[model samples]
Target chain A: MYSSLILLPFLSVIALNLPFRNLMKKLAFVVCLLVLLVQISLIVCPSICIWSNDLDIFGSFLQFNFAVDNLSRVMLFCIGIVLLAALFVQRYIIDDEERIFNFVNVLLLILIGMDGIVMVRDIFSLYIFLEITAVGSFILIGFNKDVDAFEAAFKYIILSVVATVLMLSSIALLLIVSGSTSFSSISDALKTSPDSLLISSAVAIFLCACFIKAGLIPFHGWLADTYSAAPAAVSVLLAGIVTKTVGAYTLIRIVNSVFGFESSINSLLLVIGIISIVIGALAALGQRDFKRMLAYSSISQVGYIILGLGCGTTLGLAGAVFHLFNHSIFKTLLFVNSAAVELETGTTDMNGLSGLSKKMPFTAMTSVVASLSAAGIPPLSGFWSKLIIIMALWMSGFYVYAVIAILASVLTLAYFLSLQRMVFFGRLKEDSANIKEAGLGLMFPALILALIIVAVGLFFPFIINTFILPAGNILGG
Target chain B: MRLFWSYGLFISILCIIGFYCILVTYNLIRALVGLEILIKAATLLIIVAGYITGHEALAQSLVITLIVIEAVVITVAVGIVLGIRSHNNSLDARKIRNLKG
Candidate 1:
C-alpha cells in the first residue's frame, strides 16, 4: 500500500496531460490534495517495507523497498504541504493552458521522484531517484521556455551533470570496495576499517556532489540564478523544499547511516555551512529584485540547517530537521507573498513596490509573518529552530560557529526588515493606484502557511518531541 | 590489477580534460562535448570497478541505467542549446547573459 504513495503521483502526471485543459487543472489540484491526504495517512500509520520483490527488475527487487522512518515521515509531510501550496498558487500565476498542463505534469513527476528519494534504501536507487528529481526540475525551471528561463535551466543542467558524474564515480569506487550498493552493505564495509585513501576520496567526491546539489558557497553559482529565473510557483517549490530534500536531506542521511559521523566530515560540513551563511546573507543584502533576495536568503538559511547537522549531536540533528521544516513553511509563504505582489504590481523590483500593505493586506501581512519568522524573531517558528541549532553548536563546543550563527541571524533580520520596509511599509507608489489584492487562490495558501508557522511556533515543544526528536534519533543520540 | 589501474589513470585524464573543456570553453557545444567525456569516464570506471569486484552484472546494469539517463539528459540539453541559439543567435556561453545580480 505504501507503493501507492509513489504510484498516485506517477498516475497524476498522466492525468495532468489529458486533453481537457480546465479539467486537467482542477484534476491536478485535487490529485495533489489527495496525495497530501495519502502522505498524512502514511505519517499517522507509519508503514515500512523491509523488502519487496514485486517488480524483480534485472532479477533484483527494486519495488517499494521503502524505509518509512521518522526522517522520511517529516520529509513526506513537508513535500505534501509544499506541493499543495505550489499547485494552488500556480493557478493565479499561470494562464497559458499548455504551460499550466506542463507545469502540473512536471510537479507531479517531481513528487514521484522525491517520494522515491526519501523512501528508498539502496544507495544506487537513491541516486536514480535524485536524478529523476533533477531531470524533472530542469524541465520545470525552463517550463516558460523564455530566453532567461532556458538560460538558467542550461546552467542548472550543466552543474547538475557535473555533480552527477562525480557521484557516479564515487558510487563506482564504493561498489568496487563494498561489492554491494545497499546502504547496509556499504556501512558494513566501512566498519571493517578500510584504511585506504581511495575510500576517503570516494566519500569526499560523493559529499562534494551533494554540496553542489545543496548550493553551498563554492558550489552555489547555479542556485540564485535558477531560483530567481524560474516562475514564482516553481521558485516556491525549489526554494521551499526541493533543495533541502534533494541535497541536504540526502547528505544528512548518507552521513548518518553510511559514513557514520567522522569528525573530518563534520568539520567539512561546518566550514561549508559557515561560508554559505555569510556569503548567502551578504549577497542577499545587495539584491534589488524581490525574488532574488529570497533566493539568497534561502542559501543562507540552508547554511543553518547544514551547520546544525554538522554539529553531529542529536540536538543538532533535531535542530536541523526542525529548521528544515520551518524553513520550508516560511520560505514558501514568502515566495507566495512575492507572487501575489508580482501578480498585482507586475514586477518584483523592490523599488517598484511601495506601501503594498494598503493594496494587498493579505499578502503584506503574511509577508511580515514569513519574513519575521525567517529573520528569527522571538515567538515565531524560525526562532526556535535557530535557537536550537545555536544551542546545539554551543553545547558541542563550537563557539565560533555559534557566534557566526548569531551574527548571521542579526544580518537576516536587517535584510528582511529592509525588505519589509522597502516593499510594504513605505508610501504607496503613484503608479500603484489601480493595483488590487491578489485572488483567493493565491492568498489562501499563504495564509494557511502563515498560520502553520504561528502554530508550529506556539507548539514548538510538542512538535520537537513528536517529530524532530524522532528524526534526530534516527541520525544518532 | 595493473591494467585496471592504468585504465583508471587514463579515465582520470579524460575527465580532467573534459572538465577543463567545460569550465574554460566559450562554445556551448564544446561544453556539451566535455559533459559527454565526463560521462564516458564515469561509465568506464563503473565497468572497471565492477570487473575488479566480480560483480560485472551489477556494473553492467548500472552502466545501462546510466547510459539511458545520459541519453535523455544530453537530448534535453541539446534541445535547450538549440533554444538558446535560436533565441540569442549565438551558441557562445557569453551570449546568454540576461540574468545576473
Candidate 2:
C-alpha cells in the first residue's frame, strides 16, 4: 500500500505524457483520488501491506523505510487533497494547453518524489527525493517560456543549485564521518560519536543549506520573484509543502531526533526565526503585487514556525506544527484567490483592482477569510496558531521575540486590512465590473481550503490534540 | 622536510587559485567555471585531509564521487545559464535586480 502511494504518481505521470492530453489530465485526477482514498484508509488501518525490510536502490541496502505514522499521515493527507484540488483548478486556469499536459506529468513526478521523501527513512533517499522535487519545480516554473517566467525560473535554479551544492557537500562530509546515510544509523552514530569538529561542521553546513531552501530571512531573496512569476497552482506548491515537509519538517526531525536541539543550534534557530518574521512582514508591507505579498507573507509565516521550533518546548513545537498546517491551508487559498483576480482582471497589482467584493463575491469572500486568517484575527485558523506560537515564545522566556511576533501579527493585520479596503471595499473599477466568480472547478477547492481554515479555527484542539500533538511529541522527544 | 613542505604548497596554491577564479568572475558562465575550480580545490582539500590522517586509499572513492557530482552540477549550471541568458539577453547579474526584496 505504501509503495502504491509512491508508485501511483509515477503511473499518472506516464498517463500524462501520453498523446491524449485531455484524457491524461482527467485520468491523472482519478489516480490521485484513488491514491488519496488509499492513504486515508491506511491511516484508518496501517497493517494492510507492510513494506519489506530490505530492498536496495542504486546499490545501497535500501529498506522498506515506510510507515503510516501520525506525522506522515497528516502531510500525505494534506498533500493528496491539495494536489487533487489543484489539478482540477489547473485544467481551466492554465493558459497554455500544451504546457498543462507537460505540467501534469511533472506534477505527478513531484508528488511521487514528495511521497518518497515522506516515506523514506534513509537520508540518502531523502536527498534523491528532494532533488527530484527540485527539478520538477524548476520545470514547472519555466513552463510558461515567457521572459518573466524564464527570469524567475533562472533565479530559482541558481539558488537551488547553490543550496544543493552546499547540502550535497555536507552530505559527503557527513558520510565520511558517519559511515552511513541512513537516518536510523546516523541517529545511533550521533548518540555515540564524540562531538568533534568534523561532524559538527558538516552538520552546520547542511543546516545552513536547509535554511536557504526554506527561505528564512537571509536566503529569501529568490522566493518572492519566483513565486510571483509562476502560475497560480505552481505558486501554491512552492508556498505549501515543498518548503515545509522538505525543509522545516526535516529540520524539526533532525534537530530533535538526531542533533539534540538544546545545544548551540537551538540558539541560532531562535535568532534566525525572529529575524525572518520581522523582515518578512516588513518586506510585505512594501509589495505592490498580490502574489508577491503572499510570498512575503509565506516567509513571515514560516518565520513563526521556526520561532516556535526555536522555543525548545513541546508546546512550542506543537504550535509550530499546527501553524505549519494552518499556513499551508490558508496560503493556498490566498494564492488561489489572487490567481482568480489575475485571471479575470488580467493583473495582480493591488492598484489595478477596486471594490472587487461586488464583482467576484466568492473570490472576495474567500480572500477576506484568508487575509483575516493570515492577520491572526480571531475566529480564523491563523489566529489560534499565532496565539499558540506567541504563548510558546513567552513561556520559553523569549519576551523580546514574543513581543516582535505580536508586532509582526499587528503588521500583518495592518497591511492585509489596507489590502482589503483597497481591493474590496471601494467602488468597483470599470475594468473589473465584468469579472465574475470562478467556476465550481476553481471555487470548490478554494471553498474547501477556506472551510478547512475556518473549521480548524473552531475545532483547533481536535486537530492539535489528535495529529499535531503526537507529531510534536515525536519532534520534541 | 623540504619535499613535504613543497607538496603542501602545491596543493594549497591550487586550492587558492580555484577559490580566486570563482570569486573574481562576473559572468554567470565564468562563475560556473570558477565553481569547477572550487570543486577541484575542494577535492584536493579532501584528499589532503585524508592523507594527513593516513586514510588516503579509503577516501579515494568518495573523492571520486565528489568530482562526479561536481561534473553533473557544472553541466546543469551551464545549461541553465544558457537558458537564462536567452531569457534576459545578458548573463550579468547586476542588471538582474528585478527580484529584490
Candidate 3:
C-alpha cells in the first residue's frame, strides 16, 4: 500500500505521456483521485500498513524506510487533497493540449516526490526526494514558456541549486562525523561525539539551507516572483504544499527529531520567524497584482507556522501543524479564486477590478471567507490557529514575539480587507460588467476547500484532540 | 592528516567564490557555471570528509547520486535559459523582468 502511494503517481506520469491526447486530462484527474482515495484509506484504517524497515530503491543497499508517524499522516492527508485541487485548477488554466498533458505528467511526478519526502526516514533519501520535487517545479513554473515564466524558473532553479549545494555540504559533514546517513545513526553519532564544533557547524549550515529552501525573509527574493509567474494551478501547488513539504517540514523534522530543538536553535527560529512575518506582511501591502499579493501573503502565513515551531512547545508545534493544514486549504482556495477572476476579467490587477462580488457572487463570498480566515477573524479556522500560536508564545514567555504576532495578524487583516475592497467590492469596472460566474470545474474544488475551512473551524476541538495533539506529540520529542 | 583539513577549507573558500559569482553575475550561463563550481567543491569535500572518517564507501555513493542530480538540474536549467533566450532574445538577468510588484 505504501509502495502504491509512490508507484501510482509514477505510473500516472507514464500514462499521462501516452499518445492518447484526448484521454490525458481525464486520466490525470482519475489518477489523482485514486491517490486521494488511497490517502483517505490510510486515514480510515490507520494501521493497515506500517513502514518501518529499511529497503533499497536501486539495489544499492541504501536505506529507504517509510515511517507512517502522526506527522507524516497529516502531511500525506494535506498533500493528497491539495493534489486533487491542483489538478482541478490546472485543467482550466493551460489552453494548449500538449502543455496540459505535460503538466499532468510532471505534476504526478512531483506528487510522488512529495509523498516520498514525507515518508522517507533517511536524510539522503529526503535529499533525493527534494531534488525530484524541485526539478518538477522548475519545469512546471516555466511551462507557460513566456519570458516572465522562464525568468522566474531560472531564478528559482539558481537559488535552489545554491541551497542544495549547501545542504549537500552539510550532509557530507554529518556523514563524516556520524559514519552513516540514516537519522538514527546521525542522532547516535551526535550523542557520542566528543566535539561540538563539527555537529554545531553542520546543523547551522543545514538550517541556513532550509531557510533558503523555505524562502524565509532573507532568502525570499525568488518566492513572490515564482508564485505570481506560474500558472494558477501550478501556483496552487507551489504556494500551498511544495514549500511546506520541501522546506518547513524538513526543518521541523530535523530540528526536533535529530538536533532535539535546543534553546539557541529555538531562538534563531523565533528571530527568523518574526522577521519573515513582518517583512512578508509589509511587502504584501505594497503589491498591485492579485496573485503577487497572495504570494507575499503565503510567505507571511508560513512565518506563522515557523513562529509556532520556534516556540518549542507542544502547543506551539500543534498550532504550527494546524496552521499548516489551514493555510493550505484557504490559500489554495484564494488562489483558485484569483485564477477565476483572471480567467473572467482577463487581468489580476486589483486597481483595475471591482464589483466582482456583484457579477461573481460565489467567488466574492468565498474570497471574503478565505481572506477573513487569513486575517484571523473569529469563527474562521485561521483565528484559532493564530490564537493558539500567540498563546503558545505568551505561555512560553516570548512576550515580545507574541505581541509582534498579534500586530502582524492585524496587519494581515488590513491588507486582505483592502484586497477584498479593491478586487471585489467597489463599483463594477466597465470591462468587468459582463463577466460571468466561474464554471463548475473551478467552483467545485474551491467550494470543497472552503467547506473544509469551515469544517475544520467548526470541529476545532475534535480536530485538535485527534489530529493536532498526536502530531504535536511527535514533534515535541 | 592536517593537509586534508586545509584542502577542505580551501575548497570551502572556492565554494564561497562560486556563490559570490552567482550573486554578482547577471548572465545566466555564468551563474550556472558558478553552480557547477559549487557542486565540484561539494563533491571534493564529501570525498575528503569521507576519507577522514573511513566512510569512503558511503561518501562515494552519495557523490555518485550528487553527480547524477547535478546533471539533471543543469540540463533542466539550461533548457529553461534557452527558452528564455528564444523568447526575450537576451541572457542577461536584468532583461527579464515582466512580473514585478
The candidate maximizing lDDT is 1
Clashing pairs in 2: none
Please give the fraction of native interface contacts (Cα pairs under 8 Å between A and B) kept by each candidate. Answer: 0.72, 0.13, 0.78
Cα lDDT of model 1 by residue, A146-229, tens digit: 888899999999999999999999999898789899888899998896568879999999999999999888999899899888
* lDDT (10s digit) by residue, model 3, range A1-477: 465567667767777667885777556656666767776676667566343222224223324676767888888888988877888888766556566667777877898899998888788888999999999999999887767888899889988998998898898889878888888889888878876677789988999989998999999989999998888888889988999889898888887777767788899999999999999999999999999999999889989999999999999988998899899889989999998998999888888888889999999989888999999987889989999999999999999999999999989999998999998998987765579999888999889988888888889989889888889986433
Where is model 2 more than 4 Å wrong at Cα? A15-29, A32-64, A95-97, A475-477, B1-24, B35-79, B88-90
**Whose TM-score is higher: candidate 1's or candidate 2's?**
1
lDDT of 3 at B61: 92
Order of the predicted models by lDDT, top scorer first: 1, 3, 2
Q: Where is model 3 chain A poorest over a 10-residue stretch in terms of lDDT? A: A51-60
TM-score against truth, every candidate = 0.95, 0.87, 0.95
Clashing pairs in 1: none
Model 1 CA lDDT for position A105: 77
